[model samples]
Target: MVHIVVLGAGIGGIPMAYEMKDLLGPDDRITVVSNTDHFHFVPSNPWVAVGWRTRDDIMVPLAEPFARKGIAFKSVGCRRVLPQENALDLNDGSRLTYDYLVVATGPELAFDEIEGFAPQSNTISICHVDHAVEAAKRWEEFCRNPGPLIVGAVQGASCFGPAYEFAMIADADLRRRKIRHKVPITFVTSEPYIGHLGLGGVGDTKGLLESAMRERHIKWITNARTDRFEPNAVHATEIGDDGQEKAHHVVESRLTMMLPAFRGIRALQGVEGLVNPRGFVLADKHQRNPTHRNVFGIGVCIAIPPVEKTPVPVGVPKTGYMIETMVTATAHNIRALLDGKEPAEEPTWNALCLADFGDTGVAFVAMPQIPPRNVNWSSHGRWVHLAKVGFERYFLRKVRKGISEPVYERYALKLLGVKRVQEQTRETTNV
Candidate 1:
């Protein structure tokens, strides 16, 4: 009997397990390993930080759900990976051997890279649900003493959407609290432009996001290199298109929230040829590591290069839809492998997102996420906000039942005309 192990029970792993179970033979076994027992909805983290959501709202216990689905769960976490031995050393000094492995462990927040950059420092974070809860507490205090605000992704940060969402959401929340005039907000980012989002600006994201910030009276500093943070100020340098420093600014604030750079978790670090310098798993189009064919990678743990070089580093975001596409392709490839066939599947890596503000939002679709794509579109509306809320509940239901690609997901995608995987490879052969 085949024993497949999935690492990390976040957005990617739980769904991956369900799809794997449905695709694999009945005799095969599936076990999920995570450091925590509850699965947190990462996308709603910005909302949680602003006091719109709580820890209970986004968390679902994993053990009970896995038991109901005939899957196994372990929360001891990983000490290190022994790829050659096909085994993992757990933090509790136990070991798990697997016939095949999927590395879906998400990125580690690099808070120490910059001095005074994390929650314990001069800033608050919303990257994780716990951090968001802390941010909410600090937010209440910040509201009482409203002042200038700085929000953005620091240099080497890939996930810029949440930074934008949090900034706008915080602005809206402040306005609702009748403290907008008292707090001056500044948007600073490593991306060369407002909506580059590490993919060279998806559709009209550049125009729409910049417009939204302007409308909110939020000033910005693009191509920014955040030097460090002080008690009440953020010091950074803005770079020009020619790769030179354009200006320097020292923005003062009562509260600051800046996204941190992402690196690989300690478990997968130092595995030669298996991961990049940043510790992201290296995989082929089929999501299988070239050095270790039995291993697969998905989500933020996978290595993706920058779309283009900028004055400061900016990595591409592995958004929800894109990660789902990766999960689908990995499932198909693993199933094919079990059938003694070569892997031939490749994910579309499409970028679909809803950047929610307090009461309005921006939605975008970039098919085949890289540049020169087939379909590219973006729009803004209050309906996007409602849709985002509905998505949270629908996704929670999926986790509770361990139902991947549920009927509603399929029918909804069909109704909206969204393709999940690459139907045709770039290769052309003459018949």
Candidate 2:
């Protein structure tokens, strides 16, 4: 019997394991390997950081759910991926071999790239649940002593949504506390322009977000290279179009939170032919590794080229919708391999996103995440915030029930004429 091993248990990995299980043979074994036994709803981490959500509200134990589905589960974590041996070396001196391996392990936050950054240092983060808890405490301390606030993503950072969300959420929270007047806010980013979001600004996102930030009285600095974070200052350089540092200054704040660059997890690094220099998996359009035929990749762990070059480094984001499509396509491709057929399915990589600013929010849809797309649109409303909340609840329920794709989710996207995965080959489409 073939054994399919799925690494990581975050958003992409969990759903990937569920979908692949459904497509595999009854006799085939599926094991989910994750560093943590609990699956945390990451999108809610910012809320957690701001006291809106607790650990129990968004986190779910994976053991019970996987056992119910007759799938094996491991949370001890992995030390390294020995692709040559086709085995995963565990952190506890054990190894698990797999006939087919699915690398869904999410990103390893590159906090070390910057000096005096991260929660333990001058800035705070909401990338992980534990980090959010720590950030929550910091948030309380900052609230007690209101002052200047600096919020944005640093260089090489891809996930810009959370940064934007945190800035607004923090703004809303401070306002609710009646301390908005005391806390001046500034957003700094590696993007050449505000709202670029690594997709070169989605459908006038530049204009929409800039307008929103202005309305909120939030100042911004783009093309910023954050050099270091002192006790109450962010030393950064602003690069002009000529590729020279236009200015150097210290942006001071009592509180700071910047999304750092993301790199591949340590385990996947140094695995030639499996991952790129950044430790991100290199997969073809089929989501399968060219050299390692039996291996596939999904989520932030996969390498996606930057939308375009900027004065400072900025990686393109792999949003929730895009990740889900990758998972769907990977599962189908593996099933095809099991059937002794070449992989044919390709994920649409559609970009459907909701950026909530507490009470109000922005939503966007890209039929194909890449440019020259069929559908490209963006709008903002309070309804977007409500929709984001609904999504959190719906997604958590799906994870708890181990549902791969709920009926409502499928029908809803179908109504919008968006697909989870494109079934036809590019050649067929060309014909």
Candidate 3:
């Protein structure tokens, strides 16, 4: 019987384990390894930071769900991935072997890249539930004594949606508390423009976001490379088209929340032919590692190039729907290997995103997240915000019940009239 190991329990990993279980034989075992015992909805983190959602509201304990699914679950975590041996070194001095391994550990927040840029340092973070819980406490204190606020993604950051979401959400929350005028909000980003969002401004996101910011009286700094976060001031370098520092500015703020660059987890770093220079897993069109045939990668830990060149580095985002496609493709490809057939399935890599402000939001669809796509659409309204809330509730229910269905394909994409996977041969797609 084949023993498949899935590393992580987040959005991609949890669904991956459930989907693999459905496809594999009764004797084929699946084990899920995660450092945390619970799964937290990442998209709701912005709301959590501002006291709308609590930790318990978004978190799902994986032990019960996995047990109900007849799957082995380990929360000890992984210390290192030994791809050559087809094994893993667990955190508690134990070794686990597997016939095939799916690496979906997600990205390690690189807050240390900038001096005093971590949640423990001068800034607050909403990347994790724990971070958001602490950020909520800070938010309450900041609201009571309102001052200037800074919010945006730092250099080399990929997930730009959360940064934009938090900025608008914070604005909305402050207005409700009647402290928005007291807090002068400044949006500091590494993108070349206001809504570049690391995908080259999806479907006039530039126009929509810039207009929204103007309406809310939010100031912005684009092509900004944050150097350091002082106690009450942020030192940044604004870059020009010539790739040189155009000017240096010190913006003072009492509160700050900046998204940091992401790198692969420490466990997968420095593995030859397995990871890129930044430690992202190198996967082919089929989601299989070029060097390690038995290994597959999905989600934020996998490498995807930037959409275009800008003065400051901006990595492409791996959105929820895009990552879902990766999980589906990996599951089918692995199943093909077990059946003694060549892997033919390929993920469409489509991006369907909902960036919610507390009351209103923007939604976009990129047929293939890399751009130069077939369907490039974006819209903004209160309905998008409602859709985002419904998504959180729907996703949590599925995880709690151990449901393996692809929610995006069945609901989100069907509503949008989009496809999930290509389902064609590698030769047909010229892969």
> Which pairs clash inside model 1?
none
Against the true structure, what is each candidate's TM-score?
A: 0.95, 0.95, 0.96
Error of 3 at 308 (Å): 1.1
The residue ranges of model 3 lying beyond 4 angstroms of the native Cα positions read 414-431
lDDT: worst 10-residue window of model 3 = 417-426
Candidate 2, superposed: residue stretches over 4 Å from native: 406-431
lDDT of 3 by residue, 1-431 (tens): 99999999999999999999999998899999999899999999999999999999999998998999989999999999999999999999999999999999999999989999999989999999999999999999999999999999999999999998999999999999988999999999999999899999888899999999999999999999999999798999999988999999899999999999999999999988899989999999999999999999999999999989999999999999899999999999999999998788899998988899999999888878887876677889998898889889989998999999998767776654444323332345676
Q: Write the per-residue lDDT of candidate 1 for residues 397-427, one digit (tens) a residue.
A: 9999888884323533443344432233222
Against the unseen true structure, what C-alpha lDDT does each candidate score? 0.89, 0.88, 0.92
* Cα RMSD for candidates in order: 3.2, 3.3, 3.5
- Best of the candidates, TM-score: 3
Q: How much lDDT does candidate 1 score?
A: 0.89
Which of the two, 2 or 3, has more TM-score? 3
